[model samples]
Target: MSQYDHPTNRDPSNKTFEPIEHYGVVGNLETCALVSRRGSVDWFPIPHLESSSAFSRLLDGGGGCFAIQPVDPFESTHRYRERTNVLETTFQTEGGTLRLTDFMAPMTDGESEISERTLFRKLDCLEGNVDLRIVFEPRFDFARTEPTLSATTEGVHATGDETPLCCWTTFAAQPFEIDTAASHATATATLTAGQQEWVGVSYGEAVAPTTETCEQALVETVDYWREWSHSCGNQAECVFGGPWHDLAVRSGLVLKLLTHDETGAIAAAPTTSLPEEIGGVRNWDYRFNWIRDAAFTVQALSNLGHTAEAREYLSWFLDLCRTTTPADLQPLYSLHGESGLAEQTLGHLSGYRDSQPVRIGNEAADQRQLDIYGELLLAVFEATRSGITLAETDWQAICEIVDYVTEIWQEPDSGIWEVRSEPLNFVFSKLMCWVALDRAVDLAEQQGFSAPLDRWRRHREEIRTEILDEGLDPTGSYFVRSFEEDDVLDAATLMIPFVGFLPFDDPRVRATIEAVDDRLTSETGLVYRYDGPDGLPGGEGTFLLCSFWLVDALALTGRVEAAETRLEELIGYVNPVGLLAEEVAESTGQQLGNFPQAFSHIGLINSALHVSRAKGMAVPGTELIGIELGTGATVEAVRDHNHSDT
Candidate 1:
């Protein structure tokens, strides 16, 4: 092996240049941290996703960060702990091989409620000797407040806000130094072969953790994840069983991490202000829950046999219904069900890649998106089908929503895309409105509920006729984006078959899919959401979710081989640890938009399941041996088991 000085800090010139896909996600369900492969905790929310961020280096260089990485020039690789959300990154250096494990311990009771606010990390020297450095910086409230740092016998304490955060390590704290001017702390350490160290950071009111306690928490965290994975049951019983089983499970975990355990609210992503188009003005906060996104997420989880999540989301939905009329329902809400998420720009910092106007709350919450009714109805219908008994109150709300759809189906409103333009008769929106009535009529018939079936049937038929008449092009070969613009092709039209508006084999549906493939797909097979404007100026990357949609459409149309090939290619777009972002830049193939996007993962799960069933593949089953971490069993042993099976 060779010897060299490790890279202690990011180069001054390239501080904020890490690609969005270059990071891995680790969360304790209450909150999450985005750790770059280079070992920086760049983006993390304190206490919860909706709370102010304590580490915002991802958005701006000087914002804040907590990092521990090799100071030498080295190559590294990373993966998640087997069947768990824990992350492991290994650096192969000239002097030695160093492995770092990162995780937020899960609740031991194994319930969804998250009470842990600590991010745990362990470092081991696998060979020779290596040097490393650690940096801890906290910028509470988006860097508007700086914490005063002081060292304690337990570790370093950052006191500024009501609740202080403490960073503790197993080793003596001799190497640490408080950089008062920069509002951060730094440390350096050297490890020989076979040596290891444990470190952690915790916020909010809690006892300062000792080395032994952190170690025990790590063990419990592994057990928590393994039990949850085991609870998923045999792979043979899943709708899609193949080599993608592990990826699918990981995607499910990603979706779960973004959900608020208590309220069942699912955020679109666990981040805010990450740009859809780098250096463009399209950045918006996604930390809140959107009714449409959450509905789709619940349905996906239900399909994956995690009906608990589905039931929870429905309960949350019922709460929203109690406080809302169908006509006045907002498109999105805070995790606790607040509707006023006022949008604002934080002018203090530069965005990722110098993108300006870092945004906070989402203004789209107030948009008149009519497609959410369809999404909600579909979620309820799915939950009811999955043996989740809907409350009578839920049924009543469903009926009210159907009645509202009947009155508003003819009116133009923001479509599924949430375009800011004047409301036009978007074909996708009309199709989903039809879906609402169609599914509502079925629910009433199946449950023998007292819904006005005749009225619903009449309106459903009318909406279908209108779509066939106006939503379709003059040649009737394909559906257009909107009635006002009949020539434009839209990727959303490809959902015609998936939502049962038309059969996959229908010539019109097939032509629409082909049209999108021809016009919206890049050479790399990534699909654009659309080519038209959304009343916003900059261009966005190819949407990852839409690409997955194409995979499902391809499979449903009997193009099994093509769909399988496409699925494999899309899976390649996942980050080093199997997480996906909202979009990928067509020009560079770099991920864009928010990191670990729930919708992108949902698309992966749905499309993979669809294609796997179509191709007649069975999920390969692996025997899971729960490793007791404190019993001298190495973390690597568990990772090896999962890697081999996968």
Candidate 2:
């Protein structure tokens, strides 16, 4: 008789959902998988990041999952490999220790093409004997179609539609038992010290990888990430170096992961319908690329020594601009540059943690977000400042965008928050319209691009004057959210200094900061995007991006110590593997909204740069869209100006 006993079947239907923070992400720059701390691959979308999920146990209990874990009781801990997205989870059982290494095969350098669509999981037993259970259950099309599972020569094959899912393993000790009625496959294995097993799940064709090939793929993936990390700005220019350097690097990696290698389009987040407020109706799809988000992402990455990504994104944006008139531009688009993103609710699968109305395809794409004009133009201005040259065609497209901004700068729009309420003349939108003209004039003068300089200048100054007058409340103490809601403050006003709309020490800017700090800040010091109504049914967690904006605002206003303290506190909210979500629950501190949000990571990088510069560290690319990060003279000048005003 065999010494090892049969492992207990841990049914996928009985598996409880993991906390949002209790997961680490791995990607091949195409699609990503969310691996829970308990050794379950719960959320994975095949073919692409925006595709319908194959395993969505993160949302519904009976959706699907592929879990490899000890049958007996065990505790698990996970962390990403240093400077890479490769996740390593260690399971400690009473009998021995098992290590689970997970990663998608990475693409080669200098190319965005993905040649492999595979997820690899390797298990290594370090000591004593351990019995492990493997469960492979895949529900295609968001669990709407149950796949037919059949045992292949290498492992198990699942076919639901045209796209087949293949699972291959090197566990020759036990063959997988396919349960067609249940739509799952199971296998058990026992290993002693130094024994290792490998599993490969391919989204397309099945290719059984041997032990040698798995080890080689692991080495290549690790090398690819380490090489990419070594190429970051901090490696050469030391763009960020301090106690928080590792977190900054991790943020950069997260941004890179969210970026589409083939198209240079950066998804706001990989997954859709992870609620901002649990069990509320605030969830929306974020898989598409937003102009504002991608522009900010470009600036952050370029500052971090990934200028190639910026150039590619600019190319992608220019191409997108070519397809439509500037007057009809949308706020967001698909990864392949498709503009029509009709929102639809997936009523089949339950939302993450029972958040209802799981949605895909963002409707905000149809909303008129005027801030994108400024953001896109500012990205161009920053790229030009970084020595990236724009083609004549690109210049023409930009001029059209700037001209459109001139025509509509006075109009009320959805604004940056994409509120579904009535359109109001948001102060932030006007500020960005000014930014659009300001950068356009600068670009025209510097690059010798032909543009109506006088007209641009007139609109620019008019915008500045209008904002100074109308953007303020009756008390004239600080900026308001909008002209209609003059009594309400917004955290977006913290960017007044960031975009160089006003000096950091400007009295109005100071008052705005103070007002937001007093009102919009949570008890734990996190900033809410706004306390005003947004036509939504429920409230959301505190915005992580806005909190980082506060950090930047503090650093810019000569409060370096306070900025550092706040930043440290915010860093404490990151998960164990150094990943941040879109928001954090104010009461519970639990991560809320989408996991590994690109905007949150962008905020982390920018705030780190600001804090580094405030501490007298010379960061490269600090002159972002005329927002200066000087330490000595800038701080003293702000202080002197404040003193004189007093």
Candidate 3:
């Protein structure tokens, strides 16, 4: 069989590998690394998310990797530190059992500057003697440049051609050697029961961290995370209750990992060019921040009474407006606020699963997606409701976005999914155009600040009328993906009730939800993003985000029992460490696309909120308990409680 015929954690090089779902993630807010179950740091971008990669083994066989694992075959399991991003994995071999903990130290709360670029891993032997191997490789610029590895007084350092990295080990003398043939440094050690060792890597400036310093950093980092998470406020009563509380908090932390601390721009996902389908051209870079996705992220966090994220993004958005051309805004921008991101492909490196055309920048940055106006305005409106008042200048900027949509709402453009096909008058786009006008008017009137109320109201009503009249199927039973195409379904149209274009119980919205679930849902209850041609070759997996949206829709429409059942099944498919990818293949239940996807986690947060609130639980600010979600509560018990009756 061809290598791509099935999923494996190993790269095409036929080395020891784990499947994508077996990896756990750790981040320090600036960047993240994917650590396999067996303890290989397969993917890591140095300095920042969009920076040149230092460990690209997840994408290419010869791409660099830093791995530390037991030399013997072993059984293992992994999990994150409670309410923190730190990951812990345990490997049990016939001779001994060992545990490895991984993390990147984070900046303290209220600190705005980034002064450290360090990642730490600690290994402890809990049982008999165990032999271990450590490999440290530094391949600069996506393995295009090989750094010169030299021994340092403390350990070793790689200099030349990109950011320099310093690595140190706690083993006695920890002898290190440069392996030019493999482009890596190798070390081996043995540990007895109760023995521990620390390994650290620092990018940018060289800092020799002793074993004592590394151990102290671990303690401080754990305390920092626990404190910050506890400050999420009144968790006992909020949308997260019972067994699912930590899962919700973990989702929130994952979203935080994807966000740039100084800029507040949240990436769609950290890695680029992971395919939506194996061996397909559907791979695209998702490291940059999309305005639509970021805005939705702001709204989701705000609903949980977490206003700090919304405040930061609002500041970032205002900064963009001040420097950018007001009349033309692109769909995405670089993390540092740069507006241009030209798409490019790397031919030298093999893609994950052999998916070709590994892309760097996104081409969709140039495409016109009209729905962002509504998404941005709605986020602003939600923030205002939470007592965040925008400056007059910021308010003016919002009006410009709304005004632009009024003139071009009727024009065809790339819809929300960024279909590469011909632009059409997509129903979802028109519906959001209406949302733009609706929220703009609401913000203006509620804040007692604005002009053109009559014009805005009229435009909103007109867009609503147009969508209802032309965007629905001729059968009058459900909404169509686009007015200019054959009657086909899109899971995105489920947002009709989500964005408040219509009430949840509105007959049309209800029918649309039912229609999507019936036709687009897989046997596993995951939703396919869309079924028709999308200007790409090869089939993709079921879109995990859309399935979460269906969960919210069902709960909101008083189908709480069904929603709970679906949600329980959905959560079971999350990665081993309570993380999620952008999509999941129906055939094998293997995770596809980028790992630790922001959209997927955001959907989880929002869907959980809906399920919690529909059952009469308090919104995120109060203490709630006794609901069996995530707590091993039986499905029969969930069926007995009527959410509306509470």
Candidate 4:
């Protein structure tokens, strides 16, 4: 209920809220939010991930919240309604117990009943004897202002002074009285074993709802989530098919909810500024889409065999690609392509545990992270394999990116680590440069696209040789983040085998794995990025995504059992919803950073797919272990498949 305590204690007020990680994600391809173990929705942004928040309590719990926690200290359990948008949270108290089912289904695909609004339908005890309590507290504009709460024919309403935001609530049964002195309302009711109760919260431009009309809306909403869950279809053919395919597919559906379906733009994660290092200045907005994450995300969908989603994202990305040049492309951008995010903090209600300086926007939008060019190219190339035809202008724009990458491939930039400290020419950035040129040649040869084939091929080989000769250690046993550092382990290195930069059998890859174990791992199995100040001073929970990356690499190397053991350990970190955050703190068994991060989910899906495919297992049934990412395929196979524009 409070912000988390800062790890370093440099800023005692910057508390990082250790959110209990149990959330069932359901979305309608517009946006997704995280609902917790105690049945509190700590993280969710209305309208869009990048837009102003509808619920900001996850970042600053004092901001405001509309939670349905058990008032009797009962046993609470939660889950997603099998393949649907419906969320079920059950509370078992001594006086029998109750179930709270939540969902927000979109009205008839293109319906015009409302311009833009979310109807939160909380259904309880349709046929059970239990008492249920409800709290509807409205805090507008990051909990900066207090709204006036009042009763309505529908149920309840709250309006803020400065923001034109109104929240309307409705209940199915005759509920309890209002608690105006608390600036909120509470209702407790006992239902017969076969009776049902409902509560509805509508935000944004709201109109009065008749009791009959409101009840109908709840029914329609349940139908909406069920329909969305069905869209996942037979796993492997979508984007990331096979093994944990259901998990991957479901996560994709959640991503769809966090995305603007019409715009093809996807948010990094639903929550913002949730802190990387507790109480450290590491919190940044993640609602915006990132160019670097695009390829991985598309790759996940492509791997699932979701051709449409893959192509849709690229189409959306290309729209944002009208940059002055490739180098001008920012690492991340808002869903609508707005640039220059300024950072702001809220001083009210205290932070989650008092992690002070609750940030609203990310200021790292314009940093020169050169690796994005390669990532972007990789994404476009994958779209082609999925059967998407690129327009001439699109192809021209892609080539421009390649051209720009050529000019700055040698410069020292912000590296893949995105270190806030001074810039360095990270090995990951240069490696991606190689990927860009390598894929370009393949694309031109297969698609008959106009390209300087010989020049590109030479450059590709040259980059590879330079990496081997200069970027690696003299012994050729390991690779470093930069030419200046020791053999440091990076979660980014899980990418070595993936990008075809090295074979799973390569000694260098093996050494990197061992080096990672020696440096970044905790005795209890958590992993860290590396041992250094990344532009800020403090500590953080181990990076969960990176740990999963290690799991995939172990599988690739044929260490199946070892990989599985690690996979299970990592899975243990997941809250009840099968969702993972950005990092993990071994000492506390608490999830850190943002909730329901896309990268962590991508790792979970990709590794599951690789291990599942390698071991011949499926995702929803058995957790895959010891599967390698880039094994089995020969160098020739990679080259041929990558070059075959078909």
Candidate 5:
């Protein structure tokens, strides 16, 4: 084997991958894929991001997949084509070098056209004569239907009892070969230097074959990514010449794609029921956006120069805030602010690795996590600042949200990670409550939004002082995850610096970082939310976004190179496809939880912009050191991570 190739190390059964194997991600908001370093497409869900997956090998390789990568599988190298979502992965084989470029045909003008039926994958040979392989595999219903493969002049395809819903692609560059074990067809093509080949793995219900060349699709895709990335301009000095900022802006554009453009509902990620722990019941569907995530989504977008996106999300959020019965303040809500997310399980499909009872809805929608109030208000305050004029009724509804926070800010509840263990007075949730009231009071005074300023201010200060004095660990300089736990530290509280609750350089904030890093950081260098006794069973992958948050924390706290080093290392963790799973198992290198998470991308956006602003460049189109979303917040990095109450 070439020294540059991945070492032929012992293959441990439990560990199927590395934390950094997921190098590229591509999706249409309805579904996404995690491409590995070896040019393999591992995880994908279709019809919708939240729909049952058509390719789910990320959770279990025994599941469905259509892997068309370099043969004699080995580690592949990947990178994004500067400032765009287009991912280029080069497979270095002992025989020759081959490159595969992957990207979704972005919508025109960088604006998502929901209901558009399309997904694109392109292959290019960079240098050296090499053989390119293609696989036409359709494991419909997740390997349930035994598809019969047939090669035709048009292309190779799968026809089975499931019928038309199960579709495959054809290739002219290579001949089709069938694999009896995986029940799939494969193709191999030989290309000389500089030869370019185009392949499409498209699906439609007996639709017309494309007369449109791959060149047309490539042009359209480039137009879409370029236009969307146009909004990435404008930020302060970040970690470097704006790698993080660029990542954040691109990530935001991707996240926006998952939203129902018509209804403003965003999916949490794009895949569902992928477990955080193999054989563990932690698997849940991330197809629908939770209110908490929407708040962050709006916050990240508002600073990225996306006023329209902020307005659209705020419109949905405003409607949610206007919910009557005071019971509407749920820990989780649908993208449209729809409550009552009834939970269900799909028993027909044997779970990935028998991670039984794949779930569809979130039960946490019924949980009364106090943090939602703060997240809701924070989004609204941004809306008001972003040129939104609230009506009198909306303002009154804001007061009610504040009132609810005032009454329950002190109550114990599940923290942001939604630990199902037991309710506690989560410090992060309380701080957000303070943010809600404080922003409300500020808006009423600064933007002329009508509200009861005096009461809101009182509640705000009350929360601030209470957290400062009572939220601390007493023995340590840091705060606990909850008032109930004496030593349970939470990385969620790291946002104290992020939300302007405390400056990044504050000694106490530094102390909290130290505590979290020391306590929650894994041996593999990833961060966890915390290890307090939550109501879950199996352990989870590292909270991928928390690690980025640490990178942001390190940079803002003057550890520039350290922050850069961490950021670089973390970036390496992305799959070969430039997509990230919800979490990463540090030891095994496997990704856990949902695919192409929004929370991870949102954090990436904010952290990148945070780095940019720290270096003093806020103008749109400025040469920022980081990625700048036109919105206010700079994302230090982007990962497809997500969160919820169990």
Candidate 6:
């Protein structure tokens, strides 16, 4: 018998959650699954990204999973099929070598259509004979409801409260047994050299797979992903060329996967309740679309020459704006643009790595994040600059949003980090408010759209004056996190230069960057969001998004070489399959929080563009949007000025 055939490894009771970085993701642009290196589908939400998980082993041991692994002990390595989201895992066992290909097929004949909910797993014995085992266990509704299992001619059928799941295989006669008490199914098979087999599962009315159908699906899915990636500007034309080109493309692909194709909404991340600090209460759901995150995502994709996604997202946001007044606009919403995301905890399930109170929704949805208006308007401004025309109603929505910002920009509210403490006058929030008015005035003048341009211009200058005066430290050398916390340092202020709030050569911008570098940076150069109390207990890992923002800050200030080095160090934190989590542990270098985070990837894309531009490389689509690279001063001149100041 093989080593894996032993009771300890084969038994479901012995299963444990894998590290957040141990898994690679595959999706159909609607929902995604996290497949571990051990060949287990541990976290999969059926129907939609925000729907109840069909496989929740990532959260609790009792949460179910579907795994296919060699019966023999083996070492495995995996990668995505070139330019596509299809994942291939190769296992090297003493008995033989085997390859496992996993993907969620788009199931569409054309690019414009939506995809069916189906996952395919194909196996090939590349060398000698090999023995394999298949375990299918699904805990529907976060394990609250036990699914009724029945054997089928093709494989097994599981009926639960949400949706029925059908698992089928191509093995002869489909030999598998259902354990009704445990609510799981199991099967085993052995194949000789060059032999192949397939396993597939579908949700709802999708047809069960045969070997031929699975093969066809693989080809179609690969083609779809490759075509989509190519549309994001060919690698030859990629502004970020050299060692960072492939990484940039992969980040684009991840952002695309998190986006809902039908609704044009982008998820913050594919998973929920992955803790920022292990065993901490900082975990929150990220599957919903935050207007702040989606706006950033749209701008990043548009800069990469993928303007269609930008157009779609703008259309969706405008539709949402039409239904509500500016005061009622939520910080986040469902993929279909609905709000009311009441936060709740799944008490029955243990969180990832015993982090308690696994959460399902986000309370930050109800918080007043004034920064989203700036982000949304900036995205709209960039979209129009990229040649996307807005309809009259869309322009009307933009006007109302800008007008609303004029009234509330001075109010204290939740900062960009969504602190749970009482609202304070956050510098980042105020900065984005400035961005909203600046872009609004420019858009109105350029497009000849009627608006209160003079009022917007006045507010824009007033915001700049306020930030320069009260938003600074007592020494007046650096920007503070908020006016309330004058001594605290925040990394979000790194974007002041990127947003054109100040010239790169401005002494305050330089001082703010240096202050964050000295106070908030980890030993590994990763950046923490802030150094003040956030009303939450326990410390979290350095924020990846903030780290990338620092990268941009460095590059845009005459520190191109320093930015390149920091960019390389940050890229080293990506998982083996080129995915980034929300945060990275400073002590152990382990990734923490949600896997395949959209915000992190968005930051990487924008930073790459900034660095490339700083290096005097030609970046497409940036000229149209007027991305400020620097103050046109030579690096030596800027360095000399800083030296002389010192």
lDDT (Cα, tens digit) per residue for candidate 5, span 416-534: 88778778888998888877776677667876766667887788878888787778887757878887778888888877755556655566789998887888998867899887889
Per-residue error for 236 in candidate 3, Å, reads 7.1
Score candidate 5 by lDDT: 0.64
lDDT of 4 by residue, 378-425 (tens): 777666755788888888888888877777788887776678888876
Superposed Cα deviation of residue 65, candidate 1 (Å): 0.2
* Residue 552 lDDT, candidate 5, scale 0-100: 73
| Segments of candidate 6 deviating more than 4 angstroms | 1-13, 107-115, 231-237, 616-646
TM-score of each predicted structure versus truth: 0.91, 0.93, 0.91, 0.87, 0.79, 0.94
Model 2 poorest 10 in a row by lDDT: 1-10
lDDT (Cα, tens digit) per residue for candidate 1, span 1-646: 1222344333221364577887888887677899887777888887778778888888998888888878777777778888788899888877998999999975333553333778888999999998887888888888888998888775688888635788878876454788888777878899899998887788885456666677777778888777665244667776557667778888888888888876888989988888888889888788888888888776666556577778788888988887788877999888878888888888988999988789998888888887888888777776676677766887888889999999999888778788887888888889889878877887888887898899998999898889888988889889999888868877888877666666545788789989999999999999998877689888899999889989977876778789899999999888778899899988888889988898898888887677766674332111112211111111232233221100
Would you list the rank order by TM-score, best first? 6, 2, 3, 1, 4, 5
CA RMSD of each candidate after superposition? 8.4, 4.4, 5.9, 5.8, 6.7, 4.2
For candidate 3, the 10 contiguous residues with the lowest summed lDDT are 626-635
The predicted structure with the larger lDDT, 4 or 6, is 6
What 10-residue stretch in candidate 1 is worst by lDDT?
A: 623-632
Question: Which residue pairs show collisions in model 2?
Answer: none
What overall lDDT, based on C-alpha atoms, would model 1 receive against the true structure?
Answer: 0.78
List per-prediction Cα lDDT, in the order shown: 0.78, 0.82, 0.78, 0.64, 0.64, 0.83
Give a tens-digit lDDT track for model 6, residues 107-129: 34365322358888999999998
lDDT of 2 by residue, 11-126 (tens): 33465667899889999888889998778899888888888889988888888999888777777788888999899988778899889999987654555322358899999999
Give model 4's TM-score versus the native structure.
Answer: 0.87
